[model samples]
Target chain A: MADRREPLHLIKSRRDSALATLVSGVPYLAWLGIRFDRRGDELTAILPYDEKLIGNPLLPAIHGGVTAAFLEVTAIIELAWAGLWEEMESGRIVPDAAVDSAMPRLPKTIDFTVDYLRSGLPRDAYARARIVRSGRRYASVQVEAWQDNRARLLAQATGHFLMPQG
Target chain B: MPQGPDLTDRDQTRIAQQFIEAIPHARALGMRVDALGEGTATISMPWAEHLVGDPRSGVVHGGVVSALMDTCCGAAVMSHPAGPASTATIDLRIDYMRAARQGQRITATAECYHMTRTVAFVRAIALDEDDGNPVAAATGAFTVEG
Candidate 1:
C-alpha cells in the first residue's frame, strides 16, 4: 500500500508546483486574480469577482473582455498541462525543482472566438477547457465559464493556438 | 453604412469620455477615447508592466488587445446614428496577427458597419507604432438598446 501511494503523492505535488510556476510566469494572469484547481490532469480556472473587472456600470456586469481573457487563460493552461503530463509521468523533470526552467513554452494564440450568452454577474466565476484536437503544431480548445450554475454558462469560447516548437 | 444624425464633435468627446469613465476595466487599463464619429470610435491604452503576458518576450497579453477592441466596438455602436443607449457583446471573434511590442501605446479603431432593429455589427483593428501592421483584428455582434 505504501509503495502504491508513493508515485501518486509525487505526481500530485509535482503537478501542483509545475502549475504554480506556469501561472506565476504570466503577469496579467496574476493581475486578474486567476487561479487554478487541479483534479488529476484536469484543471478548472477560477476568476474571483472584483470591482475592477466590471465593464458596464449600469448592468454591473463583468467586462466582456475579462470573460474572454479568462477563457483564453483556461485554454492555454489546460493545453500546457496536457503537454507537460507525459514528462511529469516519466519523471523526466525533477520533482518540484527547477520548475521554472522546465516550464514548457506556452502556446501562442492564433485566433479566438467568444460568445457572450449572458451578462456576467458581479461574483466569482469558474471555467473549464476541453481540448478538441491537439496536434504536433496546432491545438484547438473550447472553454465555458459560469458564475453560479455549472449547467448555465455565462460565456463560451473556442480558441486555436500555435504550439511552441521544440 | 447608413448615416444617422451625428453628434457634435464636442458632444462626441464628452459622451465618449463619460462612457470610458463608467467602465471599471477601461479605467484600470487607462483606455482613452481618441476620436469618435457618428459610427466610428478609436481608443488607445499605454503599456504597463503589469499587463505583460510573457516576461521573456515582454509582450502584452492578447486579452488586453481583446478588451480594447471590445470596448472600442461597443463605443462605436453607442455612437451610431441609431444612438444605442447601451450595448452588450453577443459574440466576438479576434484574430491575433502579431504580438504587440512592449512600451508602446496600442490603439484600436472600430466601425459600426451594420445595424438592425436590435443588433449591431462591428469590426476593429489594433495597432502599435507599426503604421501598416496590425497587432490584432476583431469582428463582433452586439445587442442594441436605446
Candidate 2:
C-alpha cells in the first residue's frame, strides 16, 4: 500500500517560527503529534488519535477541547497562508492582543468561537481551512474536519488580524 | 439590572475563578471574566504569542478560538444556579465572519438561551474591542452531567 501519511513541513516566516517554538512546549498537543502541511491558500493538519484525547472510553468520543483546538489551529494556519500574518504582527487589529498574547506586542488569539458540527471518534482526524475573506486590516477563515472521507466538521472558527501603522 | 433569579455576584466570581483555575490552557491564555448574570457570561483573553500561528507576522490560531468558545460555554453553564455542573458538548456550530487582528484582545460573550434539567443551550459571539461586528458566532448544546 502506498504511504498515506503526509510529511510535515516547517512553517516559514518569522512569526511562524516563533509560534512553532512556543507551541512545542505544549505537552498535550505535543503528545498528539499534530503536524501541519501548507499549500498555497490551503492548509491541512493531522491530529493523530491518542487515548488521552478520548472523552468517553466506552463511546470513544474525542474531547470537545481537542476538537476545538484542531479546528482553531487549522483556521489560523489558513489565515497565515492567505498572507494576513503581516498585519497581525504590527498589532493594529481588534479582539486585541492583551487577552490573547503571552508576551507584549505579540498578537495571539484574542477570541475564537468554534462550532462543533460532529463528534470526533477514536480515529485519527484531519482538518482543512479556507480563507473566507482577506483584507489589509482584517481577515476571515473557515475550517472543516474529516475522518475516512466522512465530513466530521469538528469545528469552525473566525479570527481578526491587526495591521501595524506606518 | 432586571430582577430575576440570575447568578449571584458571589456565585459568578466563584465560578469564574474556578474556571480560570480548572483549565490550564484557559489560564495560560489569560482568560478574564468580564461579567456573569441573566444566564449569560462574558470572558476576555489577550492575544498571546503562542496563540498566533505566525508570531512574526502575527495571526492568532483558530484552535485558540474554539478553546475560548468552549471555555465560555462551560463557564456560562457553571454560572447557573445548579452550581458547578459538568458538561459535555453535544453540538457546537461556529460561523467565521472575519479574522481577528493581531495584538487585539478578543472578547467572548456567551448566553445560555435555554436550560433544562439535563441540557443547556448556549450561543456566543467573539468580537474585537470596537465590538462593531462579530468575528465569529457559535451556538451549541451541552449535556449537563452530574
Candidate 3:
C-alpha cells in the first residue's frame, strides 16, 4: 500500500537511499539472493553461492551469466544510489510521501560487458561498483567480483545505463 | 588444441541436457533445451512470477533473456565441430529491443559464428511468439579451452 512504502527520509546517503532497499524487491534479485551493501563510497553486492548458478559441472563454477547479472545489478544500484546522493547534496528536501512513491529508482542498462578473469568457485562472491561518469542521460560504471581476495578478481564488467529524466 | 571428431548429435543433446540439469539456477528459471543444430542451439524458459522485473507490468526481466542468450551460446559452442572442451563467457553485450510478454515462454537461439584456438564468437536472438521479431539480441565471446 502507498501508506506502507519505504520512506524517503532515509536518503541521506547511498547506503540509506530507498533504492538500496527497493532493489531486494526485484524478482530476479530476490530469487538470486543478491544483497547490496555500502562500504564507504563503493556499493558492493553479495551473491550467495547456490548450486543452481553453476555453469560447468566439472569446474563447478558459478554460471557466467550469474556473475554478469551480479555485476550488472551492482552498476544499476550504484548509479541510483549516486543519484539519490546528488539530490541530498543539492539540499533539496523530498517529503516523506513523495519518497514512498518514488523509491524504486532503477535505471535501464543500455549495454553491459562482462569478462571472466578466473573460474568462480562455488562460494559467496562479492562485487563492488565504481561509477565513472553520470549525467542526465547516461552513466558508465565498472564493477569487479572477487571470491577470497579482492585482488584476485574472478570477473570484471563495464556497462552503460540510461539514467532517469531530469 | 582440443580438437577431434565432434560429439554426435545425440551425444551433444545428452551433454546439453546434463548441462541444463547441473545448473540449479537454470532449473529455477524453468530453462530447457528446445532444439539443436550444427553450431546452433535453441533454449526455452517459461515465464514465472519470479521472473517479472516490473511487478505492475508483469513483463519478464531483461536479465532473464540475457541468461537464456548466454546459456544458449555456451551450448552452441559445445555443439561445434571444433569439439569445445570447456568454455566460459569472455564478454557479452545485449541490446534490449523490448520487454517480453508476460506468461509466455521465451525462446532463444544462438550460433557460433567464428572461433579461434582460444576464443569463440557468438550471436543470439530471443523471441516470444513471433520468431521474426526479437525481444533482444546479443553478441559475445567465450573462452574455448581444453
Candidate 4:
C-alpha cells in the first residue's frame, strides 16, 4: 500500500525508528499485506481483505489459516517493535550504524493455538496483541481479531515463541 | 419407503477430489489432492516463490504449512463416514518441530479422530521427501452441522 511502503531511508529521515525500518524491510509482512498502526505503546494491525484470501467459496469467507497467521504475525511484530525501543533505551547497542547491524530480534514460533469465534467476512480485519509474559528465552502472546467491532472477535489465538537473542 | 443407491467408495473419492479442487484458497495455494480415503486425506504443495518466509533460508513459511494442514483436515472431514453435512473450523493448534527443506514439496495428511453430533476432531502432520521426521503437527476441532 502507499502508506505501507515507507522505505528505511524515508523512515530514518522521517521517524528514525527501528520498528519502522523492520516493518518495511520484512518481506513476509508486505506479502501478507499487513500494516501496523502504533498508538503509544499499544499496536493495532490491519489486514485489507482480498479475493486471494478466501478459502471456502460457498460462504466466501476469509481462510481460517490466513486469519490465524495474521494474528500470529501481529504478535511477533509487536514484540520486535517494542523490543527495539527497549534495546535502544537500555543502551546495549550504540545509536548509530550499529543499530542497523543489530537488527530487531526474530521470534521462532514454538506452538500456536487459534480459536475461531465467527467466520471472517470479506472485508478489512483488525487485530491486537496482549503480551502475557516475556522472559529471557521465550515469550507468550494472546491475540484477538475482529471486523468492524473489536468486541465481536472473528478469532482469538495464543502463541509461545522462542526469543532469539540478538 | 423409496431409497437411493448408496455412493461407492470410488464415487466418494471422486466427489471429495472435486470438492477440494473447488476451494478458492486451495486453488490459490496450488494445493493438490493426492488421496482421500474413508477417514484420511493428503494434500501436497510444491515450493513456490510466494510461499517462502525466510528468503535467506528459503524455508517455506510456517503459515503455508498450517494452511496445507488445515485444508487436509477439511478434506478428511468431508470424506469421513461420520462427517457432518457441513462444517467450519472451531479451533486449531499447531506445533512446529522443524522447518521443511527448501525446494521440497510438502505433504500433509489428516484424519478425523472423533466425531460427535456437533463437532469433529482432526489430527495431522506435515512432511517433505527430504526428511522422515514431520515438519509440524496439528490438532483441530470443527463445528458440524446437525
The candidate scoring highest on DockQ is 1
A1-166, model 4: which lDDT tens digit per residue?
1246657566444334555666665565677788887755578999998887888887889988788778888888777666766665455543332455667646778888999999989999999998899998989999999998889999999999888774
Clashing pairs for model 4 are none
Q: lDDT score, residue B101, model 2?
A: 86
Calculate the i-RMS of every candidate, to one decimal place.
0.6, 6.1, 1.6, 1.6
**Which is the better candidate, 1 or 2, if ranked by lDDT?**
1
DockQ of each: 0.85, 0.18, 0.59, 0.59
Candidate 2: CAPRI quality band: incorrect
- Model 4 agreement with the true structure over B35-82: per-residue lDDT tens digits: 777668888988877676655567776777878888888777776776
Winner of 1 and 3 under TM-score? 1
Please give the RMSD to the true structure for each candidate, in Å: 2.8, 10.0, 5.2, 5.5
Ranking by lDDT: 1, 4, 3, 2
Determine the iRMS, in angstroms, of model 1.
0.6
User: What are the per-residue Cα lDDT tens digits for candidate 1 across A14-115?
Assistant: 778888888888899999999999888889999999999999888789999999999998998899888887777676764342544677888999999999
TM-scores of the models, in the given order? 0.94, 0.55, 0.84, 0.86
What TM-score would you give candidate 3 relative to the actual structure? 0.84
- Candidate of highest lDDT: 1
Ranking by DockQ: 1, 4, 3, 2
TM-score of 2: 0.55
Model 3 ranges off by over 4 Å: A1-20, A88-100, B1-15
Candidate 3 chain B — worst ten consecutive residues by lDDT sum? B1-10
Model 4 steric clash total: 0
